[model samples]
Target: MVNENLATQVSRILSKHRLKINDRTLKRFLTALESINDVLTPELIEILVLDNLTIGESYFFRDRKVYNFLRKILPSKSDWTVLSIGCSRGEEVYSFSMVAKEVGANFEITGLDVSPQRIEEAKVGCYKFWSVRFLDENELESFFNKVGDKFCVKSDYRTNVTFTAGNFLSTSFDKKFDIIFARRVLLYVENEGLAIKKMYDLLQDEGLLVLGLGEYFPQVLEIFEPIAECPCVYRKIQRKEIATTAYKNVSEIRKTADFTAKPRAENANVKDESKKLKAQKEVITKTLERELNLEPALRVVEHCLENKKLIEAENFLRKLVHNFPTHYLVWKYLGILEMEKGNVRIAKEYLKKAAFLNHLDDEIWQLLRLTKGNG
Candidate 1:
């Protein structure tokens, strides 16, 4: 059973993207989250969500039969554009380049994944032995160099490829592809129907779509025609549109799942900005109380100093001394402000008159001596 509080919080985030899971899954994932981090901060929560959803093991030539299927089925278009969704760690992309070359297909590949760590690794064009384990001897000889224990992809297969980190369900790249490899991704999504429709729309006319063997979506078949002898691949045939009523019912289900995720907790940047703004407000309130004079509100000025609002205090005191030249505390604080600003000569003049107001004041005495010594 999922604890109500944890379920509520996790579901809120999931629902915004039309996703949900059983309470049991949430409980186990939450336990994993707690084991990793003691505090439930927004950063930790973001890490948990992204880590769970985007993580997948990938290696070169994974499911080689799929690549062979694509090579056999390539359209005659001179330029082929392929979108590799969830191309974790870039193994698929480098592998695709080799397959495209063997079939003499002129193509460009775009790799997208939701994991920042994976996207960065993809861009680095370097891979550990684990990621290239399936590379046959000839492929190893032609496409990679053994650097220490890892393999680096030669530039020929690495060109015309780009990697970006993004959420698949929420954001869409505004482009179409002749082929979209969405293998292994739909198994993780709650709304496979929605994802399939999205991929369908992303395809060019009669374009091809492939999925992992484990993923299945019978409902979305109205838009995609399955290919013979390809267990999980589909060719985008002319639309056999669903009835309007059924489409509306699906829309309503999505709307029911839609929820507003809570805004993240107040962060350090927010707290510091709040303090700085509050200090500024206090300075304004106190400055106004003294009729903009630095005479009676020295405590407010000191409050600004204590808060390290030297810019605000200096500006206020500069204005105050300009209007009330003979005000002792006004001149005294101006001297202190200038001293902090490293203007010892100017500070000496202000301190001399402030000391004249009350020669016996120990603070004024010390300030005067400080200005003179520093000068």
Candidate 2:
């Protein structure tokens, strides 16, 4: 029989890592944890539990579009400082190094993740073929040397990119980044508003905050302004500017507001100003809900990703792509999945379809870069 007390303790620990497990999953999870290390030291328990529970998926050159866009907008002559939050195994940081070199821009990139094992792997700078499948043949030849079955990163790429392991919420940085890549991270955070505010504080003035496609929260508007041309890009602005934008948004809502409130029966022609105003408010609320309502299918995919359930995640994305036909984001994520799986040919086909449907997504554009060359 499973000890209820032990099970509760495990649940509390995983909760700190932003996981909420049901009683059944908890039982199965504890079984596996015990099988790995029955001694169950506090540190070991935390690590084992989180390793199985946290949200993490990564690859070299995973999102090609984001880098391509950065290359164009960032000053090539400046010394660029970039940060990748929740950088699992450091593919994102390494990708930026390659981008800087290709763009002929001097740069420093820091990758931060909470898993110590991931940090250790990143420090080793060696990866299985699966982790770097997105890099074309030329990139693979240029950046890595095969040892047995794994590839080790060359010295040039490893020199400036540093990996740190810690809770990002409690960590401190000495300097702000010119750009921060926060893709696919917020969905796993318990207090997303606080996490986002911290990201804003970590940016240089007017620095860019890149989020996952279709990821937005009301709190984001309080600290940043969306770049109109980029689907997931937001730029930090002064508080005054945020206030002005908020005011304009309210005014625009009012202008578009309409009502069917019953007026005085004797003077039905005259509108009840208060009821009309309430109706306008209702309309605004409904519109906001419609806009932020993430597709249920996509949420399922995120949940699968969080748990490292690749098959489920892939299946969900494939189904969404089939059902919606032109749902570009699903196509984009599906392509990312294939790239991670080392299927470059199929990945390119899916990514190209995504780009054709939604050209502005920086995520899709970046991955397309690899298909051009095998070496």
The numbered model that scores best in TM-score is 2
Runs with alpha carbons beyond 4 Å of true place in candidate 1 = 1-9, 16-25, 240-375
Q: What is the lDDT of residue 142 in candidate 1?
A: 88
lDDT per residue for candidate 1 within 179-230, as digits (tens), equals: 8888877766788888888888899878888776435555545465556455
Tens digits of lDDT, candidate 2, 1-375: 666656767878766666444567667777766565557787777887656666567777654556767778765457888898888888888878877876778888999987888888888989886576445457788888877768788878877798999777778999998889887777667778788889998998888888765555656655766665554577888667545433223333344334334333412322233344344445444544443333546667767766777898898886677677776667777877787778888888889988887664555778889765642
Residue 93 lDDT, candidate 1, scale 0-100: 87
Predicted structure 1: lDDT: 0.69
TM-score of 2: 0.65
Off by over 4 Å in 2: 15-28, 34-37, 247-375
